[model samples]
Target chain A: MYVAVKGGERAIDAAHAWLAEERRGDASVAELSVPQIREQLKLAVNRVMAEGSLYDPDLAALAIKQSRGDLIEAIFLIRAYRTTLPRFGGSVPIDTGAMTCDRRVSATFKDAPGGQMLGPTFDYTHRLLDFKLAAEGEVPAAAEVEAGTAQTPHIMSFLDREGLIQPETDSDTTPPDLTRTPLELPATRDLRLQALARGDEGFILGMAYSTQRGYARNHAFVAELRIGTVAVEMDIPELGFAIEIGEIDVTECETVNQFQGSKTQPPQFTRGYGLVFGMSERKAISMALVDRALRWKELGEDNLGAPAQDEEFVLYHADNIQATGFLEHIKLPHYVDFQSELELIRKLRREAEANNAAPSESAGASGGNLSGKMKEGAAE
Target chain B: MNEKTDPNAARKAWLSLLARCSAADLDALWTDAALDPDHTVLRTPEVGSVMVRGRAGAVGSAFNLGEMTVTRTSVRLASGEDGHGYVQGRDKVKATRAALIDALMQTAEADAIRAAVLTPLQAGMEQTRATRSAKATATKVDFFTMVRGED
Candidate 1:
């Protein structure tokens, strides 16, 4: 009779105790506060908010604190918490044109309606580390401008007016929520955008990088990139109007790609759009590039078999939570399967030795050979 | 009273008013008697998050910014009146009080609520806003130059 591994409960409890102690390393040091993480590790909080698809800065901060600065783990905490809350209703579509922009720029135009306001950016700064910044230093206030009602006109609108760019038609249909539904293949542009919005920033960046390296290369010019706060409003049936619910900061990017003229339509510059929660220009720009690449079919462009252009591949692998879960699950027990494989390999070797034959059967002997062939075929 | 009106507008106004009310004041405002009518919780007060979005640039496309915590509740009065409340933060009692007030405002006690709750809250918010604007204005710097004698 074999004694079962019944001490697992005690072991798990002890491990948890050890982990809690480890989390609060060096009792002499002050405990990290949620507000500190929210303010100090702002970029990390921003990433958790962006990828987690939840916007609460406080909760993101707390998640960071609890997760011990592991951003992906913090994002998982937020995402899990997000599923528990009941949705009130969908908000009225906000007007981006009415945004009070903090940082707005247009690479396509020498001069745009809102003259490039590069507020708090690292664009022109040298990469040299400022040692003094390690210590908390008060930042002097920048000049302020009176809030104005002048709406910023989109660059694409100008191109659209001149018939130089393809017009995007508005749809009143509600988009499918990925959170509530299982992902299906051949997703709509709306669904694709929704996925890309909450997709892993690093993964999206890599995919975008691949496109720039000549795989489905579309000469993309940053038509405009703006980061600012916009009012969120919801229609109240009782009030007979929509009222501003709140405000949040966002980063939006639009890329103008090379023109494609078809038999029925004249050559017009196509566009890619990206909108993410928070001040993340890199993610937003990358998302736009990937968005454009995925639209190759609809844009009447040749499918160059780029990885970014593969909708199924990109959507399925873009989520870091799912990716990490699948990758990490490998640490779990697979002893039974491994034992069977070991037995088979040993039996095969024994048979080969006894037969005294040539190594002809070696090619077909492995269990993974067929799958390897299939993987190659699929890649092609 | 001849042409009946939908109670939605009144409810929305009160809810919005309650949302803007100071959180500290809300604790003091909670009274068991003010929630006079028998009501059943349509939905228990629970905390959740809403994804705040913004349209940052020239394009009218909205983008996700992040989420904020909101506590919400709904209650139906015994007299067939329904009230809802949504407040920022995880304060359940505040959400409940707001919901109760919403239900009460829809009834004949609308005037009493307006006098007791709405007016004071609105005045307090206005005072806060005025004080903030005054502080901001005091720091405003105006730059001008006299005509240069050399020019």
Candidate 2:
């Protein structure tokens, strides 16, 4: 008996095996340990943590390693793993106001309430690459000191004190969780913030760039950018008090937006906010800009038909994993769609051929080109 | 523990009433509760109202598609507290217990129900898991058993 070809299973197995071999590379090369990735490849780990919405650098490192350095896949793994962990309770909101900030800077003010502390930043580093380190990685320790100088207060709070902006009240109301529920059209500030925090850093950056490039020009300034740890606590009924669960390092950015206030309300500086899981400065800034663009309506600014201004456009397309998955999955089999199009072409061609068999363009042809039937009918 | 009355127990009672009552009877209850506007469904509660879904499917066969009797009611206590209870299946007692849990939960008795009801339910679930694991262990079939007489 003859058997028909069924190569899919075998092909899949072979492909996976080949991929595994490639990931490991030559046997001579030392295999990359998770710790090595975590410590040395810390930036990649940070990106995964920021986008993944999971704070574990080790897990992100392992995911990155397993995914063969595909950052998006690493993020996808983190998100999937995050869903399995049950939430015992929620955290006490970290008062970013009371943040013992390591780094604080405001472009608008030369000297603000809290003194400026530029904590461990690569801002002033020359673009020149160090070739000496490439030979054998060893750098003479640069002088280091504790960034204990500035106690920066939220710039928005400073403006709020003068009654120059909408007062944002901190509350204990159950905030919207996007992971647990389907995203709705009319989202609250909480949901929007959640989306921005986990959104693709690059995508948010470009959208933000577009806004600045005359798209939805809302003059925004980096009012405050702070990076620090915040206490997480859970309410214990037995104890009748919230207990500290853990502390997580976060990067928060708040942008002061220039917008015309409504009729009742006076023109004041509105705000845009970004809060992410790690020390991700670029992501934080981009998120803040996009956040401001999305808040056109709530702040009483008119939508200027910008892509960044559209809430639906930005929120839906922000996540890299979702975007990449849908984009890449198109490489899968699409023979059925191709076949349908082919059949439609053949049918259209047959009709055209039949029409062309007999000359339709005769005398008294009006309006446009006509088939033979039209002219013959006119003669009859 | 309010020995006299449990809010969850009351919810259970209403749930059973819904499952047992006809469409007309449900409408009558709705009318009695003055819920036509709200569908003030003293509405014949339905089980399986909550949808369980995922990328793979229903958390790995933990459930199946089926109709469940559900009952729900909005109650007003003498002290003027309003609460809702929805319970699954036709068991009036369970419905009542769930309703009691809901009502008490809304009031200061939230911790009490978590202690009394949810904790126990979670314990029962854990026990079930243990049993399922133990049974699987007993009937353990090693699929990778080597062939003794091979060519």
Candidate 3:
């Protein structure tokens, strides 16, 4: 007996079960803990924090584990959870100048306020694969060093002192939160920066690369990039002074851009800024380039209509969670829409076939006007 | 997520109320409100109500009880403009308030109307919610009675 398929839900459950088994791998191997992932696979945790816009490394690690190391899926889980959270209120902006530097470098200068200290980087490491890592390797010895007494001040401040760059004014106006609200066109600078801070790393990198290769070319120099932990503090209304709530790792990048001043304005250097959760330098730098490109209108530069320059397009499509959710949702059942299209095509084909046959049959004895009715239907 | 505060959902509600109403009623409401004729163009849509059912939790799926208003409406102004508003609440005042803004958008002072009428109504709704919550908290009943037991 012919019948319509009714086991779609059942099949989905079975498939999910199979996926879970695949994620766990062999039964003989011990399942990894969230703490272990957070400590050992730290880069993944950083990416999750950067995109998810959540600074909690532990929750990000758990999400990574639950999503079978699919970083985008982890980000989606974090974002969905983040939306449900009630806002206690915003903390005062963290001062990165007071951050105890773990890694500080300036591409523009050899020695800045904080000397270049490349802490915990794979930059100098050999590219050879290590066979020892196949099995869990022993921990390395701790670095021999005195107490960390010095803190890193921002490199942009050096240029700021000389009046060589534009000063980012403190307006005390709160920025728009994209997470809480739907995005609208003509977003502000603060809103754009927020979007870039949580934007997809690879997408930002590609756009940055395109700019360097001469599409909507805005000359950019990596003025400074810093990675460190900063303290988050919230002020109690009754107490007046703010108290430290917690600490979070952040990577900040500033790019010096060449901007020719207008008749009303004097010649001055402009800047691009990038701030991301956790220690992600590549993401932070790339974010800066893309940020600068988006400021074409405010900068009084020509609108080349580049992908990076269009704030509406970039800000709208940045988050991997939103992009992946919308893209993957297309895979959901659309049989109803497909069926309607199928019926229309079939009806049109039948009419065309009948019209061709009618001319041959009615050519002998009647008014052969199949084309006339087809025209009438088309008109309607 | 609170659909009550969702602008799109609220707009839909306003539009649906407009559809269920007569043109005379809409005109009377606007006329009574003393809206400028040169600025307004009102167009209401055909809407049918439905019950939305679901589940809720702080960390799990939300349950939507099927008893909500679930009104959907569309509006267009003389400035070749269109708006879609949806609300799941049965507050007729809210529905008309949204329609009035949509109608007034045809005028040059559309933004002023949006700022004055719509923004305040939204703020008032939020204020009313806060006040209601405070009142409920003030009257919160706590039962405390002890039974003596021998071990």
RMSD to the hidden true structure, all candidates: 8.2, 21.2, 23.1
True contacts kept of 3: 0.00
Candidate scoring better on DockQ of 1 and 3: 1
Query: Each candidate's TM vs. the true structure?
Result: 0.77, 0.64, 0.65
lDDT of 3 by residue, A254-337 (tens): 888896687877777888877777889889888888878888887789988788888877888887878998899776555555
lDDT of each: 0.74, 0.59, 0.62
**Tens-digit lDDT track of model 2 for A67-134:** 99989999999777666544434444555565545466777765667555565567778968978867
Ordered list by DockQ, greatest first = 1, 2, 3
The reply for model 1, stretches above 4 Å from the true place, is A1-6, A235-243, A357-380, B1-43, B49-69, B75-83, B97-151
For candidate 1, lDDT tens digit of each residue in A42-159? Answer: 7788889889988777888999988888889999998898888877655666667666666778888856764566656788789999988988789775444443334567766788
lDDT of 3 at B11: 36
Residue-wise C-alpha lDDT for candidate 2, range B7-120, written one tens digit per residue: 444433333233322333333333453421111223233222221111001011111110112334444444444444443323344433334444455566556545544554
